[model samples]
Target: MAFVTIRDVAQKAGVSITAVSQILHGKGRFSNETKELVRRTVDELGYVPDSRAQGIRLAESKTVGLLVPDIRNPFFADLVSSMEKMLYEKGYSTLIGTSAEDVERQDAFITTLLGQRIDGAIVVPEGAESPGIRSIIDRDLPLVFVDRTVEGLDTVPSVVSDPYPGIESAVETLSQLGHRRVGFVSHSSLESVSVNEREVAFRAIAGRVLGEDGVAVVDCDNTFRSRKDALMELLSEGVSAILFAYSPDAIAIIGLLHDRNMDPGTDISVVSFDDIDAFRLMTPRVAIISQQTADMGRQGVEMLLSRIGAKRRRRAEHRRIPTVFVQRGSVGVAPPERRM
Candidate 1:
């Protein structure tokens, strides 16, 4: 199929290409009839404006690039949906890319977004080192980091979850429930500023509640076998309750418990990050620490918009959405035999 250009729309609508261009962009004085004619012809011919070409001429794309790591993660999925909706409401289109937790893939997406001359970018960076991200910064492209941030990118505005509130509440709740020894399970394979922060927060909070000797931590990959091994490791240490820094690991452990016909509440109490639907739907609902996905998305976009087209970039602003802990059936009384 041949591509329909502005010239085609102009010819069909009985107008000059300049008229069609101005009419499409809502610029220049044109008769109402002419505007209607061009629009009708465009719809008839399925002529889509070349935003890239227009962006080059106008120095604005009215488009923003968003990059995330693994959209399959429910948290990221919700963030993406919220951001896209807000962007659309603001009369901008979203260009979304996913890295699937690969640094090289993340770089490739950044390169692609740059090639398209995106007006700005909101990134959940893959890591600290990336020529692509560095280039965007050096070029002074409007950028905001969300969910996670990279080292040396402090000058870039960011919105991330503050894990202290939720972690503290969770550990204190467990302590009140007579859980003397508790465990934390973290993803050993993935590294990020936010992930590390959650672990750090959990250690400090859990240590205070359960004491140094009473707190145990297991770091494992996302595999089921790894998660199972991590769970067994904590159980062997006589931990009556556990917290997961990563939600997928928590979900996996719950599945493993189901297969063995073990009660999550009775055999082992469970709490994890992210308020994904699956957690709520489990046979025994799982308690969660929610990072407030909608708020993160809205605030990240607001930061990016503030930086875009500013005469002088202001000192980068930072925002944190406090995590909230939700109590559910997954938490129960500490097993008498497992109590320290």
Candidate 2:
């Protein structure tokens, strides 16, 4: 089939080609009603904007890029969905890349997005630092970090949850339940924003309550089998309860416990960092520190748009979304001997 062009849309809308271009590009002054009319006409005509032509006109591909460490995880899935929805509403297409928790893959994805001349990007980095990220910043591409942040890159905007307090609360709850030997299960090293912040908070709180030797830290590869093995190891070390840095790890540990004929709440307490939908439906609902997934997405898009509209660099912005702890059945009192 022949490619539908701007002229086709203009003819259908009974407007000049310039008007159609302005409406489609979201440039210059155009009435909202007229914009809607042109959009409808374009849809009716099955018009697909020529991205090459768009690049020639605006020096941008009119595309936004998103990179996530793991798309299969529910938290990342929800985040990506929200971002895509918001960008779609603003008349921008999104290109998504899954880095699979690998720094090399993340770098490749960044290069590909930059090659495509994406207007902006939202990245959840697989590593704590990357030259690819630096390259984007050097080129002054509008960029935001979602869910994670790096240490040395101070100029980039970031949207993250304040994970320290929630970790502290979880540790305190476990300590109060008479759990002296408490353990933590984290996805990766204490370098990425979420994992590092939570681990720091957990260590501080656990040190204050249970002393240095009382805390056990286990690093897993953010996979079910790896997390299950880590949990089993912790359990063997007489850990009465475990704090999971994310929901996927918590769910995996719970499943492992069930496989061993142990009840989650009664046999071992669990606290998860992020709350997903399925957590509420479980027989023993999981306790969680919930991040505002939708809010993060909306805010990231708004920030990027603001930067794009300004057409100049503003002071670097770092916004932290608050987290809330929800008590559920997964937390219970420790056994008599394990009690503090």
Candidate 3:
């Protein structure tokens, strides 16, 4: 089949090429019915417009590139949805790319979006060594980092959670529940800002609150399986309560406990940094330190747009979104048997 063009759409809709062009480009004095007919004919004929051609014609593609670690993660899904909604309302569209937590893949995504001449980009970087994400900043391509940020790219605009409020609340709440030695489940050091912040805060806050040597930290990969041995190690040391750094760690720990004939919340207490619906719906609802995922998305896009042309006269803009703590049944008085 031949490539359908605007001419074909105009002929099928019984309108002049000029009228079709006008309506297609959102111009001209055309009735709603006429516009609808042209749109339907364009769709029926599968007349796909060349975005590069369109970009040249409009001077701006009116499109933004968005990159995430993984779309399967519920938090990322929610973030992309909210960001897309907000951008759509502003008459802009998003071109989404996934890195799947691989640095090379992330670089490839950045290169592809850049090649497409994306007006700007928003990224939730996978780690500190995200050259792909950093390239956007180096080239001054209107970029905003959400959730976690790459190191040395602090000059770029960013929106990240402090993680102190909710973490402090968790330590305080656990201490009140008579937990002396609370374990922290997190990724290894130098992985990403998110993990590093959580680890630093946990050591400083939880250690200070629980007293010297009161905190036991398990620095492992993001996977539960990768951290399972660390979990058992912490368990063997008689940690009365454990704080999961993310949703995956929490879910994995819960499963591990059940498998070993240990009861979550009863045999040991649990707290998570990332809030998820599954945590709430679990048999023993898990307390969570919650980040404003949707708000982060909205704020990130707003910042990117504001800095699209470096219009804002400043060194760099940074927004630190605070987190909240949600209480649930999963955290209880530390079991006497487990208390050190």
Candidate 4:
């Protein structure tokens, strides 16, 4: 069967094609009776309005683009799922891109999204100083940042955890439990604002509480093997407790410690920043600094929608979300033998 078009609906409903277009686009003045007649005809005819045609007519795509550093990361995956769900309900579609922690890849994704004429975007930028992010900001597209904040660009709304207070609380908890030589495991380089904040906060807190001889900062290459090696090195150096930047790295360290016949709860204590589903099932539950992943995703979509609507009205706005710390079994008193 030939596809039903606006002309067919208009003819069947005894209305003009422009009337049908106006009704479908939710624009122009029309009587309620005429609008109801057009809508009923559309339903009966199974006529699906051509989105592309409508987009061309209005000069708007009615689509949003979402960019993340790594889709494989459970945190980003959950975030995407939440955003997509919210966008679907709001009559908008999403185009997703992954940067894989590379600036060039992020730049390419941004360029492609722009080329596709996406009305707005949500980006979890790779770094605060990334030139690609600056380029996107320069375009003045309706943009929001998730998970990380860029320093120079303050106008864009960002949803992120305040890492300092959380890190400080973790340090204080460990210290009160008699942990002296505490170590921190984080991804290499303080390029991303969230990472930088966590690192800076951890070091400052650890130094203030544990003193000069009590802190160790270890850079994890953000891989399983590298994280395992880093943990082994820390353990060898007599560090009894650690604050991990993320759950996956904490898992890697735990696995390595298990291989060395170290008991996570008794021999060493660990606290992770992000909670994954698997963390709850671990033998000793992992303590986590949890971000509201679903809320973040939902908020991102809401922000994008606001930007799209406001752009139509020539306006813009910014938004932010909060984070929380969840205590679990993984963090505990420091072993006397391992105390500095």
Best-performing candidate as measured by lDDT: 1
Q: Could you give candidate 3's per-residue lDDT for residues 100-132 as a string of tens digits? A: 888889888877776566778898887665556
Per-model TM-score on C-alpha atoms:
0.83, 0.78, 0.80, 0.76
Q: Residue 153: error of model 3 in Å?
A: 1.1
RMSD of each: 10.7, 11.6, 11.1, 11.9
Error of 3 at 201 (Å): 0.1
Count of clashes, each model: 0, 0, 0, 0
Alpha-carbon local distance difference test for all models: 0.86, 0.80, 0.80, 0.77
| Preferred candidate (TM-score higher): 2 or 4 | 2
Q: Candidate order by TM-score, highest to lowest?
A: 1, 3, 2, 4
Tens-digit lDDT string for candidate 4 (19-45): 998898899999999999999998787
Residue pairs in candidate 4 whose N, alpha carbon or C atoms collide under 3 angstroms:
none
Mark the regions of model 2 whose C-alpha exceeds 4 Å error after superposition: 1-61, 189-191, 222-229
- Tens-place lDDT per residue, model 1, 1-340, is 2235677888898999989988888899988988998999987875546646642324577989999998999989999999999999988898899999888899888867765667899999986768778768765789999999888888889999999999999999999888999999987477788988898998898887778997899899867789889988987888888899988888888887778777888888999999899998986899999999999999998888878757787899889999999999999998888876
Question: Which consecutive 10 residues in model 1 have the weakest lDDT in total?
Answer: 50-59
Which candidate ranks first by TM-score, i.e. highest?
1
